[model samples]
Target: MANIQWFPGHMAKALRQLRENLKVIDIVFELVDARIPEASRNPELNDAVGTKPTLLILEKSDLADPRATSAWLRYYRQHNQAAIAVDVNDRKLTGDLTKAAREVLKEQRARAAEKGIQSETVRAVVAGIPNVGKSTLLNRLVNKKVAVTGDRPGVTKKQQWLKAGKDLQLLDTPGVLWPKFEDQLVGQKLALTGAIKDSLFAKDDVALYAIKWLRKQDQLTALVDRYHVTTEDLSLSDVDLLLAITQRLGFKDDYERASERLIFDLRKGKLGRLTFELPEDSEATDNA
Candidate 1:
C-alpha cells in the first residue's frame, strides 16, 4: 500500500492539547467508524486517555453490517469497556449517548453524591481520527450547527467546548492521526473509508485492496451486481477486475474514474452494509 503515513502538524498539537486538557474532562467519548472500529481507533489516543472513563461510540452504524456491529458491541462489553453503536442521523442518538455516558460515569456520580454535591455536570471530550464524524456527532448531540461539518478530514482545526445536555458538556477537538501506522492494513482501511486524504494514496491501489478484502468476505457479489459485471469477471485479478469494471461502465480510458466510482459507491453505502475487521481479528490483535 506504498507505506501510507500522514501526520499533520495540527494533529500533533491536538494530541498535546488533549493531554493537557484531560484533567478537566470527566469522560472521553472515543468515536470510531463502525465499519472499521479497530482501525479507526488511534492507539496513541487510547494510551493518552488511560484509566479515564471512556464510552466507545461506533458512529455511522447504519453504514456497517448490523451483525458485525452487534459482535463488536459484545466484544467491548466482554472486555469490560462501555461501548455503543450509533448512527448520527438516528432519532434516538442523543438518548443512546446519554444512557451510555450515565452508565460509564455511574461511580463518579456516586462519589460526587457522597461529597454532598448535587447537580454535578459531566464533562467529556469527543475525540477520533479525522473524518470519522466527530464534528457531525457533536452537531447532532447539540441539535444545532455548532461544529463545522464536512465530508473530508481536518475540518475542525481548533477546540471548542459546547453544551450537550442539562448536565453534560463536551469539548470538540480536531481529528488527529498518529505519526505512523504500525500496520499497513490500518492505513489501507483508513484510506478506503475516507479518513485519510484522497491525495495521499492512489485510487486504484485502494480500490484493489478493497476488492481483495471484499472478495475474501464474499462481498464482491455486491460489487458485481452494482456494476453489472459478468460471472467471468469475478475470477479476474484485482487489477483486471477494475479494468473490466471500467470498460463495462464506458470509462475505457479513464481507469481512475472507474476506481473512484467503485470507492464512492462503497462509501455511499450503495453496495451494501460492510464491515472491514471482525471482532475475532481485533481480539487476536489485542492479544498480540
Candidate 2:
C-alpha cells in the first residue's frame, strides 16, 4: 500500500489557531467519520486540546454499520469519553448535540455556579480532519448555511463562529490533518472514506484496498448484490475482482471508471452500511 501524506499550509495554520484558542474554548466538539473513527481522529489536535473537555461527535452515522457504531459508542463510554453517533441530516440532531455538550460541561457549569457565576452558554470548537462533515454538522446545528460545505475536502479554509442556540456558541475551524500517518492502514481508511483528497492516490489502488478490506469483513455481499456479480467473482484477486466488476457493469475496457464508481458508491452509501475499522480491531492492533 502507498503511504499517503497531506499536510497543507492551511492545516498548519489551523492547528496553530486551535492551540491559541484552546484556552478560551469551554469544550472541543471533535467530529470524526463514523465509518473510520480511529483513522479520522487527529492525534495532534487531541494532544493540543489536552485536559480540555471533548465530545466526540461521530458524524455520518447513517453510512456506518449500526452494530459497529454501537460497539464503538460502548467502547468510548467505558473509557470515560463522551461520544455520540449522529447523522447531520437527522431532525433530532440539534437537541441531541445540545444535550451532549451540556452533559460534557456539567462539572464546569457546577464550578461556575459555585463561583457565583451563571452562564448557560457553552463555547466549543469543532475540530476534525478534512471532509469529515464538520461544516455539515455546524450548518445543521445552526439550522442554516453559515459554513461553506461541499462533498470534497478542504471546503472550510478559516475559522468562523456561529450561534447554535441560546446556550451554545460554536467555533467552526478548518479541518487539520497530521503531518504523517504511522499506520499505512490509517491512510488507506481515510482515503477510502473521502476524508483525504482522491487526487492524492490512484483510484484503482484505493479501490483494491477497499475490496480486500471489505472481503475480510465478509461484507462483499453488498458489492455482489449491487453489481449482480457472483460469489465466485469475490475469490479473484483485488485487481482482477475490480476488473471483473467493471466488465460486468459494461465498462469492460474502462477499469479505471469502474474503480472510481465503486469508490463513489461506497462513499455515497450505495453499496450498504459499512465501517472500515472497529474498536476491537484497533485494540488488537494496539496489542500487536
Candidate 3:
C-alpha cells in the first residue's frame, strides 16, 4: 500500500481563514464520524480553535455501533470534553444542538447575564475533516439544503453562515485536511471510511486493512455472512481471504472490483453497525 496524503491548496487557506474568523465565532461544532472518530479529526483545528467553546458532535451515529458510541461519549466526558452523538436525520437534531451548545457555553452565558446582556442566538462554526457530514448536519439544523452535499469528500468549497432555527447561526466551512499523515494507519482508516479521496489509495489496500481489522475485533461474521464465505475460508491470510471472497462474488481474479464493492458496503452499513476505533484504542491509553 502507498502513503495516503491529501492537502489541497484550498484546505490550507480555509485553516488560515478559520483562525481569522474565530474571534466572532461563539462556539465551534467540531464534527467527526462516529465510526472513525479519531482518524476523521483534523489535528490542526486544536491550534486554530484555541480557547473557543466547542461541542464535539459525533455525526452519523446511526451507522456506528451503539455500544461503542456510548463508550466514546463516556471517554470524552471523563476527559472534560463537551460532546454529543447524533444522527443528522433525527427530528430532535436542532433541540439536541441547542442543548449541547448551552451546556458547553454555560459560563459564558452566565457572564453575559451578569452584565445584563441578553443574547438570544448562538453563533457557531461547524468544523471538521472532509466528508464527516458537516454540510449535511448544517442543512438538517437549518431545515433546508443550504450547502451542496455529496457522498465523497471536498463537497464544500467555501464558508458562510446559515440560519439554524431561531436561536442558532451556523458558519459552514470547507472540510479541512492536514498536510501530511504521520501515522499511515490513520490515513488508511480515514480512506476506508470515505474521509480521504479514494483516488489517493488503492481499493485493494484499504479492503485488506478492513478485513484484518474486522478479524481482530471479532466482527468478521457480518462480512462472512454477507458474502456467504465459509469458516474454513476465514483461516486464510488477509489477502487470500479477500481474493476468496472476490471469487465467491463471481469477480474471478478481479480483486480490485471486489475490493471496491466491499468498501462501499462497509461505508453504507451493509456489513453492520461498526465503529473503527474503540475507547480503549485512544491515544491517551497508550494503545492507539
Candidate 4:
C-alpha cells in the first residue's frame, strides 16, 4: 500500500492551479475526514498556501467517534489551527464556516476596515484528498447542486467558483493527493477511510488492518453484534477472524467478497464510529 502511486495528471494540474490562484484566496478551507484527519490532510498544501489563513473542516463528524472528534478539535486548537467539525446536514454549516473564516482573517478584515473598505465576502478555496466530501460541502454551502457528488473518490475533476449566501465566494478545486505516501500506515488509513479508490489496494488487506486495530481497541463490539460473532471468535488471528466473519456473513469460501463487504460496512459506519489515529500517535504532536 505504501508503494501506491495515485497522483493523477489532473491532480498535478490542479495543484499548479491552486498555487497560481493562492494570491487571491483569502482563506483555505482544508477539509479532512473526521475518522482519519491527519492521514487525509495534503501536506503539500502548507507550502502552496503560505501565510494564508486556513480553517480545517472535519467533514463527516456525524460518522466519527464523538469523543475522538472532540479530542482532535482540542488538539488543533492547542496548535493554533482553526478547525470545526461539520456534517453536511447541519443547518448552521454556512454560518459557522463564515464566522470561522472571518475570525481567522480578523486582523486582515480589521485592516481593511481601517482603510474604509467594507466587504463581507470571503474568498476561500475548498481543498482535501478525494472522497473527503468536498462536493457535498460545496453544494451545502451554496444550497444547490452545482457540483457532481458521489461516494467514491475523484468525483470533482475541475475547478470552479460557487457562491454561498451573501458572504462566501468559494473556489471548489478537485481533490489533490500527494504523489506517494511516505508512511505505510498512512496509506492504509486512507484506504480504510475511502479517501483512496477501492481498486487501488486489496480490500482484504484493509479489512484485516481494520480488524486488528479495532480488536486492539476493543471496538469490535458493533462488528460482533452485526455478524453475531462470539467473544471467543474475537480472539482468533486476524486472518482466521476475518474468515470466521466471512462464514457467518454467508459468503461461503468467498472471503474476497466478504472483505469488500466488511470494508464497505466500516466506511458506512455500520460497524461503528471509529477513529483511525489520535493526536498522541502523531509525530507532529511530539514536535509541537
Candidate 5:
C-alpha cells in the first residue's frame, strides 16, 4: 500500500522522523495491499521496526481476491496470526480487532505486567502505502473522522493520532515506500489498480497490466464480454482488445472510445469477483 512517487522531497525527512519514532511504538500495524500483499510489504519499514511485534493487516480485503487473503493468513500464522484480512468498515470489526490485537500483544503485555506496569493503553501505528484506507480505517475504528479521505493517493501529509478506543490508540503517518521494486509484475499490478501515482506509470502500461490479470481471471471477463471482445484467442498485446470489450459493453463509438471506456470499467471492477491468490495456490507453489 505504500506509494511514495510524489513524496520525494518528504522521503528523507520522513525516514529520519520515522526512525526517531519507531522506538516509542508498541506494535507495528504493517498493512499490505490486500490485492497484492507480497508486493506492498515495505522493506524499509521492516528494517526500521526490526523484530518488533507486527500485525500484518491486509487492508481493503473486500476488494481483493479472497482466496489469496486466506492463503496469506495461514502463511503468516506461524508468528501468531501475523497476517489478517479485514474490511475496515465492517460493523463487527471493532470487537474482532480488539481480540486479535490482544492476542498479538499477549506476550509483550505479560512482560509489562511483570514490571509492575498496568496496561498503559495499547498504542499501535497504522501504516501502509497511500490510499489503502489507513486514515479511513482509523476513523472507522473510533467512529470519527480524524483524517482526510480522498480518491487520490498520498493525502495524509503528517502524523496524527486517533483514539481507537478507551485503551487503543492509532498513530497515523504518511504512506511509505520500499527502496525499489524487486518484482516487476508487482509494479505493474500496482499501477494498473491505481495504487501507484499516475505520474509514475504509463497509462498504456497500466492498461496492459490490467489486461494481463483480467484476461486470465474468469471473473474479469464480464467486462470483456460486455465490451464485445471476441475471446477466440485472448491476447494481452492486442491493441484492438479494448475496442472489442468496449463495443460489447455497448459503446456506440470507435475502438479508441471503447478502449478508454473499458479501462475505466476495469478499474472500477465491473468484472466479477476474483481472489487472485488461494491457500492451495500458495501451498502448491511453496511445495513446488
Candidate 6:
C-alpha cells in the first residue's frame, strides 16, 4: 500500500500467483535492474508472505555502470543482503548468481537438516518490476529463450517455473509495478529503462533525461560524431542537448526522433553503460 505507481493488470495477476507460491518457495532470487536496483524492486516483495532469505541478482550487469554496480553489491552485502551482478542474457555471466544462489541453498540445506527437513534444492522466485530483464535472465539460466522477449514493458504477463539446475528451481514472473510508485526518480528511471509504457511518459522529457545522462558520461561526442553535430557549448541543459541530438539525428519530428535515438543508444550501449538514479535519489517522488 505504499505510494508506488505503475502496476498493470497482468502484474496484479502475477502478484496473486507469487502470494500463493511464496508459501512453497524457499528463497527469492529477485532480479533487480543493475542500472536501477533501488527503483527496480517492489516493497511488497520484501513484505511477501513470510520473512524469506533472498539472493538479489542485479540483472543486465553488462549494461550497467560497473563501478555503481560494484558499489551497490558491496552496499547490499554489507547489510547482509545476498547479491550478485550478472548479464542475464549470457550463461557465462550468470554463473556468479547461480553459484551464489546455490551457496545460499547449501547453507540452508545444512541448517534444515538440524530441523529434520532436509531441503536440497532451492525454490527461488525471480521477481522484479516489469521489463527489468526477468525473461532474459530465466532464458540464460535454463539455456533457452523460453519466455517471450520484447522491447516494451509488461512482457511476461504471468507466472512460469523452470528446472534450472539439479538443485535449483527458477520462477520467472511478470509482477513488478506495484500500486503506489512513490519516488519520482524511481519512476523516471523505470520509464527510461522501458519498464513503463512509452505513452505514459512525455518522450521529450524522457529523451532529455537520457541526453543529460549521456552528456555527463562524456559520450556526447559519439552522438555528435554519428550525426555530424558540434558540441561547442556542451554545458547545455537536458532539453538543449536533446534538441542538438534532434538536429543531428535528422528525425522529422525533433522530439520523437531524439527520444527514439536516445533510447536506442542506451539499449545498444552507444551511450555507455550507465545507471539513471543513484542511491541518494531513493527518497524522491515517483516521477513516472
Clashes of each: 0, 0, 0, 0, 12, 13
Arrange candidates by lDDT, highest first: which order?
3, 2, 1, 4, 6, 5
lDDT tens digits by residue: candidate 6, 73-93? 877866678888876555475
Give one digit per residue, the lDDT tens place, for model 5 in 161-236: 7787677877888877655676566676565555567667555555645665665665545654555555553553
State residue 53's C-alpha deviation in candidate 3, in Å.
0.9
Q: Write down the TM-score for model 1.
A: 0.96
Worst 10 residues of 6 by lDDT: 279-288
The TM-scores of all predictions, comma-separated, are: 0.96, 0.97, 0.97, 0.96, 0.84, 0.87
Expressed as tens digits, the lDDT of each residue in 14-65 for candidate 1 is: 9999999999988999999999999999999998898889999998889999
Which residue runs of candidate 5 sit more than 4 Å off their true CA positions?
A: 1-7, 78-81, 231-238, 246-263, 275-288
Best by lDDT: 3
* Number of the candidate with higher lDDT, 3 or 4: 3
Error of 6 at 45 (Å): 2.0
Shift of residue 67 alpha carbon in model 6, Å: 1.4
Give each model's whole-structure lDDT.
0.90, 0.90, 0.91, 0.89, 0.67, 0.73
How far in Å is the alpha carbon of 217 misplaced in model 2? Answer: 1.3
lDDT of 6: 0.73
For model 2, how does the per-residue alpha-carbon lDDT over 84-172 read when each residue is reduced to its tens digit? Answer: 99987789887788898899989888999999999878899999999999988888889999999998899999998899877789999
Across 1-288, the per-residue lDDT of candidate 3 in tens digits comes to 799999998899999999998998899999999998778888899789998998999998989999999999998999899999998889999988988898899899899999998887889999999999998898888888889999999999999989988899889999999989998889988998899888889999999999999999988888678998898899899999999999999999999999999999999999999998887888554653
Quality of model 3 by C-alpha lDDT: 0.91
Better of 3 and 5 by TM-score: 3
Give the CA lDDT, 0 to 100, for residue 246 in model 5: 48
For candidate 6, the TM-score is 0.87
TM accuracy, model 2: 0.97
lDDT of 4 by residue, 99-152 (tens): 989999999889989999988899999999999999999999999999999988
